[model samples]
Target: MRRRKLHNLQEEFINKFLETIENNEEYLEFINRHKPELLSNCDIAIREVKFFDVFNNTQLNNLIKGISNLNKEKYSIDLSLMSKKYKDLNYLIIQYDNSSTRSLCEVTFKDDLFINNVRAGFTQINNNQAVVEFSISFKEIMTHNLWIDFIKENKELLYGKKFFGYYNIGEMIKSAHFALIYNSISKVIDAALQAKLLSVFSLNFGNEYTLPQYNAIHVPQEHFKKEYFDNMFLCRTYEINNKYLIVDITSDEGLKMDLYFSGLYSSINFLQLLARYRMDLYYFLFEKIERFEINRRVNKYFLNSRKRIALKDYRWLINKIRSLNDNKLRENYTDSRELLEDWKSFYDGKEEEFIDFENGQYTKKYNTIYSECFDHIKMAYSIQKENLVIYIATLSLIASLIGIVTTVLLG
Candidate 1:
């Protein structure tokens, strides 16, 4: 794409990384050795792979411990973990001492597949839900035709069709395929669950594709060329659907550094965005009382003390929704912010309509939910106060009668 650069910081960072690669003797030698194959055959270079999955936080502490143990046992290395903090004022309301931190573990593989480095992590979204992310870096070179074939095959695999093939890794005698890569991921998830780290209610796998800078100027297909690259910022071609995200950068900018960073950031952020949306929907539905059932439900909420317990849960839900909504699009960079907002709008179902569907409904529903909770809690308190008054009055009468009887007996 040939659009204006979104931000200078991104450009500078990408350029610096490219410069480092150029200056490194090992990288330069590898480039020179593969120059012929790279120039003549490779149309699209698959630089990285990222996968995200959501899980329920059944045993959050155990899950973290399990992840740490898994890394130590499997990779023989400690987890490279860090907490992602939001300094935005909006986040201050939601921040708590025990808030879940993002924990990460890096695993490197040799002679297995095109993938070399894999970093996996999890971020707890709410008290009950969490998301695990996998970022894989690849050094695979593929012809333009092979690239197209891979995309097609991958799409089928994503949609639940089984297919397998092997790709030669440079001059190595052994070859690796996508099946092995996917199998490894499945094993990790299975192990986590089997070991009772975390119980999962549902699981979804999402993918992000980062093409090398060389393909930015020369997109493989004419349609994609017209759709993505024509008069758009190289980074602006952040195409996302329910299935996958395609992130690219301009050739002149540098190597695929921007791709690596942005892809990871966007994939993780988008998953969070989607998770929050689903949570909002789920909470709304869980608490929603239909008009026909409103009277019965209200009575149940008021008279039945057990049903009133949901009021506390409702309060928690309100706080969670507010935190998630307020914390959207907190990124400082323009491209990242824009991409997240775009993805939010897409998942929020605001793309086609004139009205903001998700946010508008959110505001209205939130107000209704807040008001309902307030009224129910207030009524419950009032009933308790009335009962206390009656109890005190009855006790006073009993005491007076006892005093009168004692005085009569004394007289």
Candidate 2:
């Protein structure tokens, strides 16, 4: 069989992913609804950062201090350093990386628009995970038509494209404004990576062309028809595999755009959802790592032992498989056990969108990896148990033979 290239594998994965989503009856029905001509009057951008690990003690402290000083001196931004501890759905403190110490910064993008807050944080337990969150919002009150033009003009930025040419919002203004904010955020991240404060790994599909992000749009209540669900093209942009959650807010009583986007409770809920999604990505990556590790160990075991593999060596493999299962079953920062329940309460009976969002992201894929890992663990445990019984029976036979020899010699 000919070996396939990495790019080919990525292309295949992407194709299969799109096929699965596009073929879903619900998704198809939702997409087939009458496409809305209405556009958003305001837009919000949420970017998710997944850091594999963070530095320890001195190194971490220095990086935080350096970034804080740089933010004040160069970006004219104040930094707030705080510790946050989150409890799971049952109000129990999660055992894995439950607390995070983060530094927050706020920047004003323009007179009315703001890049509300940017956070860079690391977990307290082993510093195994970190999250960076930031959002951009346009505060100008514009007519729906003007907002449509605004989205059209700034599509490049909204879509998270790195570069583009000639937008109606004045090429210079578009470039300068976004570039300044992006660069400011990028500088902090770059510094962290350079200082070894955080580390990240690339997925098999390769580096994403654009940042992982979600968009929130405020549309008029009359325009928030079922057809708007099919507007995924504009919300997702050209990144098929990088589809993000698009939340459309209307002017209904509790669903008011202003309150949904700006209310304290709503903001916190949005942050929780974002955090959960980030953690989901983390689990997906961790599972891939574990799967690769298991395969590598299995291959190494066969190659190194050939035909003389010891029982102890087998025991090591069994222990490793058990460890993998233990890690998978351990409680994490996000409590997925009650994810649906929490999302239902938060969305106020609109949990379908959340479900779709998770499915679109990596929830289904994560479950697939999890099931694969579980199978491996199960097989390893079965083998271990069988070997243990055989070893015990062999020892019993040897003892009986020794006892019979002693009796024969005495006779």
Q: List runs of model 2 lying over 4 Å from the truth.
A: 1-66, 71-74, 82-103, 107-127, 137-209, 230-265, 268-278, 281-327, 330-339, 342-411
**TM-score for all models, in order of appearance:** 0.36, 0.36
Query: What is the C-alpha lDDT profile of model 1 across 284-357, one tens digit per residue?
Result: 22222222223333445555745334554445445544544543442122322333454321222123322122
Q: Which residue pairs come into collision in candidate 2?
A: none
**Model 2 weakest 10-residue run by lDDT:** 251-260
All models, RMSD in angstroms: 18.2, 15.4
Q: Which candidate tops TM-score? A: 2
- Rate residue 79 of model 2 by lDDT: 47
- Report the lDDT of model 2 for residue 249: 33
**Cα lDDT of all candidates, in order?**
0.37, 0.35
Q: Which lDDT tens digits does candidate 2 get at residues 159-222? A: 2211111122233233434333222222222222222211112111112212222333334455
Cα distance off (Å), candidate 1, residue 295? 14
